[model samples]
Target: MRITTKKLVLCALMTAIVFLITFTPFLQIPSPMTQGYYNIGDAAIMIAAILLGRKVGFIAGGIGSLLADVVTGYYIYAPATLIVKGIEGYIIGAIANKKNGVPSRLRQAVAVTAGGLEMVLGYFIYQATVIRMINPTLGMASIIADIPGNLIQGAISAVLALVFLTVLYRTNTVKNLLR
Candidate 1:
């Protein structure tokens, strides 16, 4: 794809927003399993995906989240975060962009749900396999324990993203951006 100034600027801005939100303490809930906190950075990821398309969303979400992980001393999770978040963003963008512009509410909901599932399951696998490499049993246990927290975080992020998307659509922010 040709890189235009607007796309470049928006990508950078979204990356910065994702990093800032991911790094913020107020929105973080400490996770004992991964030692990295759960955050609402996904809200920005969802927005980027819906507005920017898959490539931009993947880059913004992945690199932004990876930077946050590195800076926050969750170095071991950086790689996993990049992959998981990138996939999540890609999934959202792909589904949301199926129509001419932004998708309908039902489609958006489906996209978010699928993307959220990716986030939840991706992290769970990382925790289960990579983090607890020594004791697979303990890893399994930890995965089980983390289920509730991950579910809650995913649900909250999805709700916030959808609400924000709705408002943006109603205000023609999405339409204006597309044109």
Candidate 2:
């Protein structure tokens, strides 16, 4: 089926929200340095993937993350961030959207798993194969460091998705497309 106008509108809004929250953080933690701060942008990535599917997810994830990086004084990491976020969004979106009648619960679990795995996989690939300057230990160390945060973000995002998607479904704004 052709991509519908409604999907485009929602995707645009979600992408905007991703950009907004990447900076504001409906939830955030503090640290002495930049590395210590955490944001829900990744959850936005997961949401885009799940709701809009891979293509839209990729676009939203890349642009949203790149914008966040630029705005947050993280321009150095912007390029890599965009690619990794795009991949994370696409993979999760692809998994969450299935042709078969998979239940929403199962798809949500899958999205969570995929979200965490993306952090693990992207870190390893970028560190080991593509670039090492950012973090020489990016190969495995990045994954190790990211696990707890990623899990927390992933679970939170899943819960949020359930709530938001349910609301949309009820309003007939979006299908229980998640289901």
Candidate 3:
């Protein structure tokens, strides 16, 4: 697909939205398990994917999350966050926007589930391997401790995305946005 000015603007807007939502002081809930904090940025990422499609989703999610990590001083996890969140956004958009028009509820559900699982697994693997390698002092126990928080984050993100999508659809916002 050819890139247009409109698409570029939308992607930039979405990226800013994701970063702002993620880094907002009140929105970030500090995780008791690890240095990571849970935020609703994933909700915006998923919504962007479902609305704008995969390419925009990947770019916005990856860069936005990367910026959030850097600004938040989680430098160690920035690379992993970029890859993981990028893939998560791509997966959601690819599945949810597979067809031409607005996605069916089943498709949206599957997309969110698959994307959320990808995020959870991606972070788990990243923390288990790369994080362990970088800081051997952080043991497996700490890695395991992070799972529940990630799972909760993913679940919350999924719910928020679905509810937002439902509202957009009901209000015909999706129709206008797609056009």
Candidate 4:
């Protein structure tokens, strides 16, 4: 597909939106179990994917989350966040937009579920292996402690994204954007 100025602007806007949503002090809930914080930024990531497609989803989600990590001083997780969120965005967009017409509710649900699972599993693997190696003091048990928070974050984000999509799909502006 040919890139357009509008698409580029929208991608940039979405990236900023993701970053702002994640980095805002009020939006973050510090995780007692890990260095990470839970935010609704994943909702923005999913919305970007569903509205703009996989490439924007990947770029916005990865870079946006990476920026949030850096700003929040979670530098160690920046690289992992980039990869994990990027893949999450791509998975959602690819599955949700597989057909020419708008995706059905079931398709959207499946897409978000798969993406959320990926986020949870990706962070688990990263924390369990790389994070464990970096800080040997954190045992396997400690590393595993973050799973519930991540799962909850994903679930909440999925619901928010679905609700937002449902509302946005009804608007003429979003319909035009999709086309």
Per-candidate TM-score against the hidden true structure: 0.92, 0.73, 0.95, 0.96
Q: Give a tens-digit lDDT track for model 1, residues 1-179.
A: 58989899899999999899898888888888656688999989988988888887798889999999999888988999999999999998898885576588898888888888999999888888887884555657667788788777778888999999889988966667766
Supply every candidate's count of residue pairs whose N, Cα or C atoms clash at under 3 angstroms.
0, 0, 0, 0
- Tens-digit lDDT string for candidate 4 (1-179): 68989899999999999999989989999876667788989999999998888899999999999999999998998999999999999999998994576788998899899999999999999989898888888777866888988999999999999999999888887878756
Highest TM-score model number: 4
Full-model lDDT, candidate 1: 0.85
Regions more than 4 Å wrong, model 3: none
Instruction: Give me the displacement of residue 24 in model 3, in angstroms.
Output: 1.0
Candidate order by decreasing TM-score: 4, 3, 1, 2
- Clashing pairs for predicted structure model 2, backbone only: none
lDDT-wise, the better of 1 and 4 is 4
- By lDDT, the better pick of 1 and 3 is 3
Superposed by TM-score, candidate 3 places the C-alpha of residue 121 at a distance from the truth, in angstroms, of 0.7
What RMSD, rounded to one decimal, does every model reach? 1.8, 4.1, 1.2, 1.2
Q: What's the CA RMSD of model 3 in angstroms?
A: 1.2
| Global lDDT of each candidate | 0.85, 0.67, 0.88, 0.90
Candidate 2 displacement at residue 142 in angstroms: 8.0
Best prediction by lDDT: 4
After superposition, the stretches of candidate 2 with alpha carbons farther than 4 Å from their true spots are: 1-8, 30-36, 98-103, 124-143, 175-179
